[model samples]
Target: MRSTLPTFNEVWQRQCRSSILSDEKQFFSKNTFLVACSGGMDSMLLLCLLHCLFPQRVRAMYVNHQLQPDNEVWATFVQNFCEWHNIPYLIKKVQVAKGNLEAQARHARFNAFQQTICSEEILVLAHHQQDQAETFLLRLFSGAGVNGLKAMQKIAVKENIKIWRPLLDVPREKIEQWIKQDSIPYVTDQTNFDEHYDRAWARHTLWNVIKPRFPKMQTAITRTALLMQDADEILYEVLQQDFKCCGNENSLDIQALNDLTPARRRQLLSWWLKTEYRPSLDTVDRLQNEVMYARTDAQAQFFVKPFWYVRYQGKIYRLTEQQKKPKQYEIEIFDCQNIVLNQKYGLNKDLLKESLMLYPRIGGERVHLHGRVGTWPLKKAIQEAQIFPWQRDQIQILKKEDVILGIITPQGFWLAQSDYCVPNGWLPKLDGVSV
Candidate 1:
């Protein structure tokens, strides 16, 4: 005789006792759970389960993307359900950004969720086994590497917010069965049947046709994702070891990067940039061809959105846009200590009585070195001083009426003219350097 299957509550309790959930028992006990409910079958089941298990610790949040005409209807349904169960509830409305409708809607939804939940709350999602399978197929079709193929996890962190998906390993059929058996109320989203979205197309068009022939495909895909997760962890460990030998958070050593194998080099570059920014594979390839392989003396730069990655002096540095400084300003000598010049450079103390004018460098401008006989072109002087090309425009030229006092380099050092120098005198020091 076939044995009777476990009830939904029994299955949930059994899963909770599993090693993964058991390991996080203390964390789950300490933090309140904010369930992301969309008034859908899966989410409603998650909300119900959590509420039934830990009623006081569970709260429901519904994020309305406002993409559909019935968005408010869904929100009201989730709110009513929460009120009926006496659970704390929050509803956030978000405007989806312009772009791929599905991606933008997802981004907006998550943004709302992230903005609503605090550090003391763990954001719980309702992604199940089939959802993982669908994500795996989507990433696979998009040519994602091991990192992407790993898909979602039971526990993860995003932007310092902890996320938990307790039902991640549970199958969708089981969830539907439990919901129907318990007579839970939920609203159906008609958009799920629309094939215009990639996930919808994969589910309705691709998976439906394949499921009959390969009934166990979802389980197989989920297993593959688990393996990929392990592979991704190993790769991260290797990258950490490689990072120590090469560089730190802000920059990478060009020579060390070049010595790595082509594949490893690409991995390191992708890993390094991903710490603060997301870079496309094409961007990584372009950086390898244009910046890393450029001639040693050549100053090569690759733009990645708002910032630029530049190669100079055997190091690749990420350059953020600096704040715009005044084009020209006049200051008294007594205030020189508050400006951008190194005080060690000698300047006549008597001249402190006169005002000095500071101007940003323009092309063809020239300055005189203190010990040198003649004037030097400002551009040539900056180049000889080894200032970064990106920082050249930020150099300040100091003047006293018609006489050129000196110029302040980006590094806060002063190049005083011979006429302005005294055996021992006062100079100013700038506080910081632009990276």
Candidate 2:
């Protein structure tokens, strides 16, 4: 009699043909599959399966944390396996930071993967349904919100590195059975059953007890995480619409942000910050209460690690750490010669021979702006131009001897003095403000 259970190859093929994994199949067909192998049963099976399916496209990467005493032995085993299978592989050694061993190891492992994998290659992980369930539970216990509770995704992109977990929904038992049936050589890590680590405690202790009472607990938890992911997608769609009305690429209108409900306001702030920086919940709360709702005249600013969100002139501008501006510089211009001033705002060839001094705003200065009748106070002019407060110091004042020649604002606008005005002369490119 034939066995009732399907073989590992049959299950893999079925999964690849499934509607959910059809896109992944197409992606893998076109991209190189770089598997993260740990020399354990799960990773070994993943590497073996991918190599069998796509021999020419499969490669393995092993990150050695040097935590366990047998790490070298495990690495050697993986190298031998890859060599036997004629698969190309790389072994990366990473220094795990001195802290929580599990978290540090994971961080080091992913950092190694990110540095090793190129843009065109796809990093494949062996996280299965049981791991997903544990992640969900861990995040829930740690007071994580919906975003965290959603846990691991089947496909994810981090720092421009694409990661695929094809076996995310597959049962761990299936992988074990396949490895046993195939007699695959794999090294077991004793730390997995130590119960000292959080994941080990969850798996060996908590899960062992829970499974006896609720056999389907893993399935239930995984299903809940999937539901949370669906909810997160809907929330993100709503956030996009809200952001469109209240925010632009780099700034958000204060009044419009205030118009949103408290929860939505926090969500928008969190979403905006997460686009480029990871902010904690406390930081978001402070931004809402201390910065966003501060007095109109108050110069409120909040620092969020390498970036600052400052409330200025009815808007919140996200800015990097301000760089020190030079006091002054000199440039020469000749007639019939066009000069490139940085990437944007080039001087006209019609300007006569002159030497101009570029100085930062020192106060009590005036500029006779082109097309304007009288001289305007430099402060008033910058305010009228709506230049950001943090950017005002970056504005350069152009002066030929005692007379103001022009002013270069951070917005890439060249407010040329009336004396230096030439029609259809200065080309505006607006790339970035550079001296």
- Model 2: per-residue lDDT, tens digit, 1-435? 222222356655665426324755676557888899999999988887777666688899989999878999989998987877788999999999998888889889989988888767999999999999999988888877788889999888887888889888888987787788777778999998887777889998888889999999999999999999999999999999999999886789989998999899888988888744346788799987778888877888887766678888788888776532322223333122334443233344444345545566778988777667787788998888887676666676665677665676776555555544554445322225532
Off by over 4 Å in 2: 1-27, 97-101, 115-121, 194-196, 275-278, 323-359, 412-435
- Residue-pair clashes per candidate: 1, 0
Best by TM-score: 1
lDDT of 2: 0.76
Q: Kindly list the per-residue Cα lDDT of model 1 for residues 1-435, writing each as its tens digit.
A: 322222456555665436334634756778888999999999998888777666678899999888888999999998877776688999999999898888888889888887888778999999999899999999988878888899998889988889988888888888887888777878999989888888889888998799999999999999999999999999889888888888887678988987888878888888877744446789799987788888877768787766678887888887665622222323434345454333555677766677777666778987677767787787787777787776676677667787777676766655567677765566655445321
Candidate lDDT scores, in order, read 0.78, 0.76
Per-prediction TM-score to the true structure, in the order listed: 0.85, 0.81
